[model samples]
Target: MTGERRRLRFRRFATRLERALDGGGAVRRRRRPGVCAALDRCGLSAYYVPAEYGGELTDYTELHQALRMVARRDPGVALAHGRTFHAVAPVWVSDDAVAAHRVGRLVVGGTRIASSLAVPGMGPEPHTGVSAYPVVGGYRVDGEEWVGDDLAPGSYVSLLSRTSPVATPRAHSLLLLRPDSLPGRGGPSGSRRLAFCDTRVGADALVGGEGRGAEIVLKARQLGWAAGSALPLGAAEHALRERLAGSRPPQTRRFAEAYADLLLCEALSLVAVRSVHLLPGELSVTSAVVGLLVPELTGAAALAEDAHLCREVLAAQFRSLVRGHRSPHDHRPQLDRLFGAAEAVVPFAPERIGLFSRHGSAVLGTLPLSVRRLRHLARAAPEFGVAAGHAERLLEVTDTLHQRLPGPAVTGDPGLGRGYALCFAGAVCAGLWLGGGPAVGDGPDGLWRDGLWLEACLTRVLAHLGVRPPSGADGALFDRLATVMIRQYEDGRPFSLLPFPMAEGEPR
Candidate 1:
């Protein structure tokens, strides 16, 4: 389905989900029992399956849109459903029939899934306390596993554990285990540990072969990077709606900045999802960039706090979506240490940057050609105006970073990574806005006004990178865009690439 149709479908569900939350923003713990029924009733559970498994895996773009919409109302619901997709992504990629069937059955049956992976940076000890030993028939597992608090009973949980005694870094494997398969009781626990023991499973329980845990988990992580990032993007969009609803002038500029940032993120996220879909193996760096930068830019926690949403609930949802996932933020030292040991690598190529692929260059030789063509088009197109300038400057900065990035001793500084993310986002916004021509919205000079928004984002990125631009920049552009955004929000339209109608219920 097209993204527009997907948004419409999600809008219908959003109404139901909005009613389900009843303005609290998440299903209460004591009310967890009926949550799956609510989700199943809305047909949200089908998204958990891939098309091959007889579920709605139309495309990443649609799934991303749906998740973002669901997140706007209840972030926890989106996190749970999205994380289940992460758990089963490896199964789909592995093409293991048994595992695929198992996952399909669960989704069709409206069962939730949980993921349990050893936390990165945890010392040699497995934080999950889950260990699988080879046994007759299959493997036996005995340890307490970590699971989401809202996971319903009889849910299928994916667990990663060490399968080899003489362990190297990659000795772990993935197992699809059930609470009933294990001889212990499993349910929501105050301690957050699902205690299991002497769980003997048949060989069919293994999703991926022995010692494939790292690969399987990495696949899941890559799939999750964009989906996980969308959670915060959705939250920020909702917060912008709430903040702009007040129609306060003093905060208009800030809201405009936030709206611009959110739009840029939407573009970057679209690029990231495309990257994962096309070049799955080479996305390690791209996924890290997205995972680290989306939440940082969206400021979901800060947005929640600012919107007066429940802090504790937001924190818990973030922990489930963001903290449990690995990104450049978690492995900065690892990258620094590894790159420090390697010999000097290849210099930066413009095509090597993610933006080049976003433009649809079919071959390496077409990259520079594509860039030249875009520049020529921008020059000829008066509508591009300032946004084209932002894109050009972005190429220069990306070139500088790429040239220096391949060398040894490059510090994996997260702030610098965030700066690069902003740079990329600015480039994407500029390119997309120019290519999309004038936006259909409230402003008289919508395209020109949006060009200023692009400039503002580039200004923030350049400042973060310590690159000074021509001075005398004013907030006038920001104020104008903010006015447009506030009007858009108050008019019952969403602040997004596609303006879908907001929930008809009264704002919190």
Candidate 2:
């Protein structure tokens, strides 16, 4: 399909999905069959398959937007259905054409696949309790596995199994097998316990070469971390909207601060997703930052409303960061393509994805240049002065962070990690605003006009870093943000940088 037509297709699907869940009570209590049927009918699985395998996925940005659209209404449904994409990610990353074609065709044909791969913000270790012993024709699979909540009798299960007795990264391997092929009984919470008493299968079931499971799974998890950030972001948007709708809405300060947090989350998510295609090698750090910060910001939003659930969520974000971080290598990213919303992304190549970033973080490393550009823009357009000032503050914060950050030999400092994440977020906002992505509009009332959104975003970042601005300055910035948010709500637009058209009709 043409680019315009493809975008239209996604928009239509989003509208259809919204209509499908109308009046469906609480999302967690809703029937899975009905939701799955709606998702399948809308061809959600097609986006999980690569284009070379007769699927429609070309850009991670489109998929990210679609997931966020789904998540805005119901995060539970988004996770339930989006797991299909998560299950297939490893196959794509393995770069095994045969396995890719097979899984891709099955996914395209409306087949659901369940996997044991942990979701983003969850730890990266797969359930390795299952063991696969090598045999004459193939491996003799044995042991119980904990699959996802959506597994079915005839559907396929992708698992990471121990191939050797030694406990090492290279001792495990991935296998894609049919549930029916193994002798197992259904377990509680939609998991399966495989009692594979000498069950045998052809060697073709292995996803990649033996002992390569850790590498492939790591890369796949990086992709998941970047894409999965949309879930909380959408939920946060839902919370902000609900707050605005109440009879006695929150003060302008509360609304604006929450809205700014959501925007910063989106900025980080957008850059991380695009890096999967443009800077796959640098994804290790980029994805970790997203996995860490999105939840913290969302949790803070929840905390403002006295929701205690965010405490657990914040813990998960920190755990995910500790598990995912590694020493950085160096490689420059395609800044033009990375920040330009209209630019076409190159096709995804799994081989290009590295286990760890060759360079630390392209987004954070380029902060100096971004600050310089913002200063130049400030000179050219006096209205940009606020954004430039914030950019300069960000540069100062990041430079100090770099000097104080512990050497590679010592890692896992919570304060240092959070500081780095906030700095990266600041850089993303600066780069995106400077690049004039689609999120930045030229209309008289646009959020980017006079760098209003950027100034608010940077101010929020600085506050998070304990670098407080003038006492009342934040209130004024937040008040302005609240006004823009109300305007978007009245016009029935999503609270996003991109102006996606919401489902037509009265606001929900």
Candidate 3:
């Protein structure tokens, strides 16, 4: 499914999603039951379960359609929903399978909803009955954690603590508690009072084992992350399609670069989503290894790709249209934020750049010398925003790993060269998300051009790497993809590629 055919097929789904989104179906989940019951008529409930469980599940193509539709309404909402979509995995892994089955039955019955598990501080806290420890039977489960707004009545809540068991001390375990177990125990008497604001649910509470809470939490977060990661990709795709459909051809290269990002993210999401079904423990931990490496790799690429897209859009139309119309009149202060949006990204975001390189080196380093050789060198690459001196220092460590390891070596003359290409692919996708736009038939132009343009650039950049072909038709696919993205970039309406403003008064 590459090139024009892929686009043709997807375009229809995207259009369908757009209609659903515009019809307010995008956020039907959080609304009143009657509203959602209407959406269910549209057959969206199929999206809620695994294919094995009578749901269409997260089919890459379908997800792309669904998310693009929802995101056009609100990226934040799409993000929030995505994070909670697969909220069932942690419970499925419960040591107390009986309880897991009970919870499953509730969900199947539409009488329940569940928030994902998260390290306590990572998520909001609730008012009452949080268990205290791996207490009498389980770890002390005395505490309260908030069920995010996405949670409806009868929805389950998950939390994580930093306890380690004596058996597998190196790793963490899981615990499950249901909504019924409220006010199970209060904090210290003198400490403080736990209050419930608008908190209401049934009573037979409890989920996983007490001490194993952390495991479920981590799994939930990963599930959430995988789901969240897909959104930007979908949105980026939507943006590219919308931009390319317009009259003008893009003058810049960023659109294509962003497209590459969309493609890469879709692939990563496919893999990450599959990783969700794994039983807990070693394989799950390995999946985490994949999780840590993903964002940093593709996330960086996405940012870079989007930055380029924004640059293209702003340069072409935004500077004149958006800036000219608003800047001169300058009546509404809010409009100013749009132009100022493209503030510079500081030299290499070390956290961003180092993520893949460091994580890959940490996990993959244990492999054969040949594998380690090529893999480690990537962490050391110089980033656009990174300081050269520091990048150089980092390079030293990477260099040592590359040089010391000896295994599969690309011959100097071997057509394919050496570099961290996968990570680079990840960066390309991330770049598209930030600046991409709406899907076609959804409405007017979106930042789609930027996605397409960025897609073009990423392809060009990746092409420079040794063209070691991918498994199947993927080789020809990337090649053709590069062309599509470039075309999209060359032919779309422009917008400023501004990073989302973190606070009020900041650029948009």
Q: What is the C-alpha RMSD of each candidate to the true structure, in Å?
A: 10.1, 5.1, 18.1
* Cα lDDT of model 2 by residue, 1-508, tens digit: 6778877877787677667656355444667677767777777778778889878788788778777777777766777787788788999999789999999999998887888632222234334667887898899877666776456756887778888878666777888888665544323233545445566767988998898776777678778778878878878887777778883666678778888889888888988898888988777677777877887897633312211212222223332333222323143555877887556677787788875554456666667788898889889989778778878988887777666554452243566767877988999988887775454575324777778888888988988999887767557667778888888776667887766545743233
Compared with the true structure, all predictions reach lDDT values of 0.56, 0.72, 0.36
- Give the lowest summed-lDDT range of ten residues in model 2: 303-312
Question: What count of clashes does model 3 give?
Answer: 82
Per-model tally of clashing residue pairs: 0, 4, 82
Highest-TM-score candidate? 2
Instruction: Put down candidate 1 lDDT per residue, 121-154, tens digits, no spaces.
Output: 2123233477788998998777776764345567
Query: In angstroms, how far off is 253's CA in candidate 1?
Result: 1.9
User: Between prediction 2 and prediction 3, which has the larger TM-score?
Assistant: 2
TM-score of predicted structure 3: 0.47
Q: Which regions of candidate 2 fall more than 4 Å away from where they truly are?
A: 21-30, 117-127, 184-197, 300-331, 380-382, 437-440, 443-445, 505-508
Model 2, residue 496: distance off in Å is: 0.7
Top lDDT prediction, candidate number: 2
TM-score against native, each model = 0.75, 0.87, 0.47
**Could you tell me how far off, in angstroms, the CA of residue 97 lies in candidate 2 after the best superposition?**
1.1
